[model samples]
Target: MKNYIVASWILFIIGISLLTSCEKDPWKFDTDRKPGLYFVELADTNEISFDQLNDSTWTRKLFICYLIGVPVDYERQIEFAPIDSASNMKFGEEYKFSDAILKAGEVYCNVYLWAKRPAVEDEDGKRYCTFRIVENEHFVPYMYSTAFFQVRVNHPREPKWWDAEIFGAWSEKAFQVYMRYYNKQEVENTDNWQKYYSTVYGKNMYIMNDATWEGVPALFLPLLKEDVLVPVFDYFVANPSDGVDIPEWYYEWKKN
Candidate 1:
C-alpha cells in the first residue's frame, strides 16, 4: 500500500509538470490579446535633419514599428495625419510625409519626410510636427499614442572620441562618415560618450559584484577598424567642395 501511494503521487506530479510546460509564455504575447504597434525611437521628441542634403527638396524617414506580434506575410498600410493644433510645420513650405506602409514580411515601415527648403529658416533652425497612428485593420495601438518629428538645419557637434591629432579637425564630412558606420541617432552621436554609453552597449565585463556601468565607454569599442576610418578620408578627397583643403596624412588610403 505504501508503494502504491508513492507511485500515485509521482504520477500526479508528472502530470502537473507536463501541463505547466505546455502553457503559452505570458510575457511573449501582446497586452491587448491582439496585434499592436508603436513608433520607434520616439519615446520623446526626435529630429529629422536636412544637414546632409544639398537639394532644395530633401527627404528623411521615421519608422512605424510593431511593439507586439510577429511580422505578417503581406503589406499593411499605417494611416496617420498631422495633428493640426499641435503642429507648427507649414505643410508645403516645411514638410510632408509620403505613404506610410508596413512592407510585406516586415515588422515596420517608413513615413518619409519630404522636406522643402523654406524661404526663411525657422527661428533656431527648427520646425516641429506631431503624428498619431490610428486604429487600423492591421494593428491596434499599444503604448505610445503620438510621435514628434522636428525638421532642423542641425550643425554637427564634434564627438568626444574624435582625436584631433589623429583625425584632424572635426568637419561635417567626418561626422557624416562616423554616423554612417556608428549607426546611432544624430543627437546621441554628438553628445558626451558617457551619456550615450548608459543606454547603448552594456559594459558588463566582470563576473562578481562589479556589474554597474559608469564613467564613459571606450571610443568606438567594437566599431573602430580600418574599414570605418578609411571612409572619412575618402569622403574628404571625393567631395572636397571647392575651396576646402584635405589633411596631409589622409592621402594614403585607397578607396575600397
Candidate 2:
C-alpha cells in the first residue's frame, strides 16, 4: 500500500510540473519588437500603375502598413505621403490612404496598389487624376482593399550629425577627426569588407550602430539631430555596404 501511495505522489507531481511548463509557454505572433521604424513588403500588382488602364479613370488604394517595434501614440505623428508618378501616370489614381483599428496601439493603414484614372486638365491648367475606394468581400470594411507596407518613424534629418565633431571643428581639426574615425587602417583593409557588409546589410543591423556614419542625411536630417546616436547607429547597421576603405591621407595625417 505504501509503495502504491509513493508512486501516485510522483505521478501527481509530474502532472503539476507539466501544467506549469505549458502555462509558461504563451503563444506569440511572429513580429519584431525594435523600438522604432519598420518596413513591410507589399505585393506587386499591375493595377497600381496608370499605363495598364483602358480609360482615363484609374484609382489607387491604400493597403496596410506594418509596425516594427513597440507601439506609440499616433496623435503626434506626421505622415508624409509621396506618390510615384514618373511614368506620366496620375498620382491620385495610384494611391489612397486609410486607417483601421487592430488592437490598442496597433493600427493599420491600407494601400491600394494600382487603382488609377487618367489625367484631366483643370481650368487653372493644372493636371489632376481621379481615384475611388471600393469595398470588396475579401477586403475588410467592405469596398476597400488593404495591405501592409514598410514604414519608418522617429528617423533623423541630419546625416552630418553622425560626424558632428568633424562638422563643428575648424577645418584642420575637423579634417583630423574625420581622418581618425573614417580612414583608420583597420577600416581600409578590404579583408574587412565582410564586416562592413555585415554592419550595413545584416538583419537587425539598424539596432546595432549609433554613430553618424550610418545614416543618409538626405532622409534623416529633418527628423533628428547630429548629436543623437540612436538614429546614426540604426542607419549604419542597416547599410553596411556604405563602408569604405580608409583613405591613405587619413593614416598619414594621423601619424603626423
lDDT of residue 168 for candidate 2? 34
- Best-fitting candidate, scored by lDDT: 1
Clash count per candidate: 0, 49
Runs off by more than 4 Å, candidate 1:
1-34, 91-93, 121-123, 154-256
Tens digit per residue, CA lDDT, model 1, 153-182: 655565555555445666765555555544
Candidate 1 lDDT (Cα, 0 to 1): 0.59
RMSD (CA, angstroms), candidate 2: 21.2
Tally clashing residue pairs in candidate 1. 0
After superposition, candidate 2 runs with Cα above 4 Å error: 25-42, 51-61, 66-107, 112-256
For candidate 2, the per-residue lDDT at 162 reads: 31
Model 2: lDDT to the true structure: 0.35
List lDDT for all candidates, in order: 0.59, 0.35
Error of 1 at 123 (Å): 5.7
Worst 10 residues of 2 by lDDT: 147-156
Model 2, residue 46: displacement in angstroms? 4.1
